[model samples]
Target: MNTHFSLFRLPETFELDNQILEQRYRTLAAQFHPDKFAAASGFEQKQAVMMTATLNEAHRVLRDVIERAAYLLKLNNIDADSPEHTHFEPEFLMQQMAWRETLMDAKLENNAAALTELAQTINQAQTELHRNLQVAFSENHLEKAAELVRQGRFLQKLQQEIHAV
Candidate 1:
């Protein structure tokens, strides 16, 4: 599979070194910079632009835990974001409801402190899911990984809601 990890010459795993990724991204960005291809033929310039876009998207997906998990699921022939496959565990569904209620209450009360606390809680949950996702992928548990990806997406959306608050 020609994944972002492949593009960076790295193994396809959840564990990645941020520093190394940053350095590689910079190096690749420089080489693919559209300006570098300006003096080239029209076809070459177009190809450079397309590669640059792909590089940028790869960098973004590889850098974000949630996005990376989803991408990996896709690589495994699973679409984690598919609406028809929305089957979250009951416990998680209950927690999601509670979190939403808490967010709603905080918004109504204009409680910035509560919102901040909620964001931290969601971040911690995201971290745990990230860890679990790594383990799932390592064990070749694609189904579990897909579930975690969907859960992470929920928490990510909650985080965005908190930010909007």
Candidate 2:
């Protein structure tokens, strides 16, 4: 698989300038959009369609902090999705459980304020994790980076659940 960084002509780092990524995506999308190839031959049109798909996938992956970190780990020979890599610190696991229970309690009580506070707490942790991920990637700490990405995934799912509530 082509690395999303290479596809977007970006450096392989956890910290990315989102504006640049978006601009590159727009440029690539405009270049490969099917309408631009409508007058071309069948093979060319098909190629454009494939390029468009690739561009979209690249944009989607690179635009998200968690996916981008996971991608960086994969590029560095770490499988973030592997079972071994899924192990989080015990404290983190306990914290996640506490957050989940709090969320449940908030929902059961129909307390929007509590839910909002929990969401904010999760958001703050996510932001900090993103910063830590940037440092980990910069220092070539692949294992640490992978762990951070796993934590990020958990937080993201929790955030989604919060939204659902």
Please list the C-alpha lDDT of all candidates, in the order they appear: 0.91, 0.91
> Which pairs in model 2 have colliding backbones?
none
TM-score of 2: 0.95
Off by over 4 Å in 2: none
Candidate 2, residues 88-162, lDDT tens digits: the string is 799999999999999999999999999999999999999999999989988888888888988999999999999
| Candidate 1 per-residue lDDT over residues 49-133, each given as its tens digit | 9999999999999999989888887887899999888898999999999999999999999999999999999999988998899
In candidate 1 the C-alpha lDDT for residue 121 amounts to 95
- Least accurate 10 contiguous residues by lDDT in model 1: 9-18
